[model samples]
Target: MDRLIQILKDPLLIAALAILVLLGAGELLSPGFARGDQIVRLLTVAAILGIVAAGQNLVVLGGREGIDLSVGAVISLGAVIAGNVMSGNDAAILPAVAAAAGAGFLVGIVNGLGVTVVRIPPLVMTLGMMGVLQGALVVLSRGVPSGNAAPALMAFVNQPFVLGIPGILFVWAAIAVLMAFVLRRTAFGWSIYAIGSNERAAVLTGLAAGRIRTILYGLSGLFAGVTGVCVIGYTGNSFISVGDQYVLPSVIAVVIGGTSLAGGSGSYTGTILGAIALVLLQSVLTTLQMEFWSRQVIFGATLLVLMLLYGRQARLRV
Candidate 1:
């Protein structure tokens, strides 16, 4: 019993448990909840959140007050740009895709530069970038996003089929697995923890703290671009604030999964679990016919509760 309580105290374990509980309850409450198609649809949504969670995990795990506030803006801008660049040509889609990705990278670099070179706090740097990027989008799109993405690109993302499993589910799962490997198995992975644990100490010990911070932001940008692309595939078009909705959800998912906001600790598995739990929570609430505002209220309450629990842990020394 004591051991179980201790395990529950661990963020990753708690997140996983939340996933199981929510998922099981969802299955019990909904008709055909376990059906492959329904499960796939739920996973499709979860994947979108998970992809963004992966990037947020990097910023959070990188420490030194690192966080990516511009992720939503970056994604929105990327999708809008991709929409314009594709302009109904399947072949042309790749170039615009590259441009969209490049746009995200640039934003991330700006974030890193602001934090490291300009000495702005991460929050302020990203908040400023978010507004700047949104303004840039309006300018680039000429007040309206007129272009359409290629048909093939849209079909690929929306259609779900890969060895009898939904393509989107498998795609996101594959991404999560690959990321898990990278973080757990690679040398650069070590630098994430080292830098987060003690930026000055890491710098003294030979890790390029600034360079790595910059690169992590770049990685965050790169991931944001991928998410934007996937979303375009899912929605077949772009709106200015479409990608912005993901910002809070992404951060919340990563944090709920047990990745410390203070950094130097976390796992992709936890993030994945957290994403799943969030999706299941939404699914169950929708099934229950909860009002939109009420759902938001409940979400706020849940977050408050989690914060209280987490705060207690943060204040403890064990």
Candidate 2:
């Protein structure tokens, strides 16, 4: 108890543990919890959100008051575009995949430029980007998002191998491992953390804060693109605002995972854990036959209490 309290007294650590305990406890009580399938489902949800969280994770790590408001937009755009690549045939899938990824990269770069060169506030810039991307899609898509989903990609995303490990799960896991290493082991990683903690100090210490921030944004964009591609495979078609809802949840996932909202202080592991907590809540609520709106209301309230508790780290905005 003493050790636990000492840990939670640190706001960031508390957020991470709270999510894990709540969700982990729920998993213990779930019906037929011994079933391997149930375990798979839990991990699957965590993997899906972890991919999205990974995309946002980079944005958070970029520092310089950074946050990617356009993530939802990028995901939606990729989904809609990938659908067009399907042609209801398998051989044409590669082109579609390429197109979707390319589009994601372009959008991410735009976001990067808006932050680095344009000098717009990350929030305001991404907010505008959110609108712009949505508008462009609306103009091009004409209120209906239609596209063919590539079957090969879908298989890659959903197919299980080596004792039922879904490829997507592997992909997400690999990315997390790679990112954690980069953040902790490499000089670039050190620069990212240093810049986030104190951009000015980083500058004095001879870091290219602008370039690093730009690359971070670009990397974040690329990750989002990859996520969008997977989303297309998972959904099998593109629909309007399919990725729209993920924006806030992605942010919450990272913050709730114990990543400092103030930047330069967090773990990708926490984000992964946090994503599982969210999926667990959704699953438990559904199994118990709870109303969706009620869940939303309760979720909102709970988030409020949590924010009040651990959000002191956000005071770094000044």
Candidate 3:
């Protein structure tokens, strides 16, 4: 009983329980909502969010009010870049991916510089970066149709690859493992936590807190870019607004997964479960035939409640 209680005390475990409850509610309401195929589909969607949230997790973990509001813009631009580079050709997929990742990385580096060097607040820096990227997208796209995703790429993302799981899920799983190792077993990861937990102390202890936080922002951009490529694969096309919907949800997933907004402590594993729970909640809401605006209201309420609960604790820690 004690062991069980201990497990239940863990936020990750709590998130998992929430996922199961959401699943149950979804199944009860929609009958086939929890069926194998349906669950797989939902997991696939969650994988994309999870990937984006991975970057968000890193930024939040790096502390000092770290966040990458430009992620959505980065994703949108990455998709546009990938689609144009690929031009519906399977052979061009690799090049397209490289272009997207590279572009996103450059953008992220700029964001990092603005935050660390220019002394801009993270929220302001990233938000401004988001606007810049959006404008760049407008100039590049010029109100024309975007390019199509290669059929092969689409298949890889949507079709079952191993044991009936989408290939994107495999990608997400690999990222999760890599993230776990980096956070648990790396000096860089330790520095992130230290800096986030107490930046002044970490700086005094010889950690280059600014540099590490900058890298965190860069990685966030990289992940957002990758998500953009994946988004095109899943949708078979690209648009300027393809990534607009992910920004808030990515933050929500990170927080829901138990990552403190104040930074210094959290795990990608929790974010993964949080992503799943969020997807399930959305699915359940959709099943109930809720209007789009109404669903947004619910999401807003959820975020508000989570902030009150988690944010309070985080503030106390500081």
Candidate 4:
């Protein structure tokens, strides 16, 4: 049964199985569980999470306790800014997107500078950024976000075309392909892995650790910004707490995908599966009418179990 064990140990397989189990549970609890519309909706939600998790994955893959806590905040702020700028106008879509991306990039740069130049701990730096962004959102929106999502965003996020495929799915697919290529085939990608594996060794080997890590943080922000833009399309509006739910979930998705918390190993493909699995779990939980607190407990418990399992495996390997 060595082959069977190996297959079971595969992260993608595990994620797929988790999703299938959840789907089965959902089907038992609710009719039309895998109906066409439900499937499309599930994919849409997962695609958004996958976009955010891509950035989180890059940050953690940079190692040294790298994590971007500000992602949720950036997403909220970006959505707000984009919604205000677009103001339901199709012609303003380009500007709205640019503004959202710029905001996220700025936050990322600040985070990167704090970590690399100021020598602050990444956790503290990102957490501080998160607080700053949250306060900023509250102040700017005055506790309530205004304006509707731009028409272009609505068309892309909520509209379906050609066999009922979501427009957001195409965007997610593009990002996944690009990220997979960069991580697996590019020189800079190799530098990130080397740095995460061992910073000092990477430096000794002529790798630019600080620069690469900084860029990774920036890319993380960019992806988070993209997620924000997608949110406006999907939800049709922005709010102060619009992204509050995503911070922990993004990290959880990355880890569940078999990316070690200790860094140096992961794949976008695995992350995609993890995202899908989490969404399926949520669907099942909702179908069962689980309370919000109960869902939180379950999510937390699941994350804790995964962490322990991966931690043990890493130690064993060492």
Arrange candidates by lDDT, descending. 3, 4, 1, 2
On lDDT, who's better, 1 or 3?
3
Q: Which is the better candidate, 3 or 4, if ranked by lDDT? A: 3
Instruction: Give the Cα error of residue 14 in candidate 4, in Å.
Output: 0.6
CA lDDT scores, all candidates in order:
0.80, 0.74, 0.89, 0.85
- Per-residue lDDT value at 136 in model 2: 88
Evaluate model 2: give its lDDT. Answer: 0.74
Stretches off by above 4 angstroms in model 1 are 311-318
Q: What tens digits encode model 3's per-residue C-alpha lDDT throughout 178-199?
A: 9999999999888888998888
Candidate 4 lDDT by residue in tens digits, 1-318: 999988888777888889888888888889789887998899999999999999999988888878899999999988998899888988888888899888898889889989999999889999999999899888888998666787777878877955678789998899999998999999988888888878888999998888888988998888888788889888898998788788877887887798877767788888888888888988898888999889889888888988886622343111
Best by lDDT: 3
lDDT of 4 at 247: 86
Q: Deviation in angstroms for 138 in model 3?
A: 1.4
Query: Model 3 misses residue 41 by how many Å?
Result: 0.4
State the lDDT at 38 in candidate 1.
Answer: 77
**Which regions of candidate 2 are displaced past 4 Å?**
1-4, 9-30, 92-94, 311-314
Over the stretch 128-238, how does candidate 1's per-residue lDDT look in tens digits? 999988888788776775567788777666665765555567768888888888888898988888887777788889988888888888878878987887778778888
RMSD of each: 2.6, 2.7, 1.7, 1.8
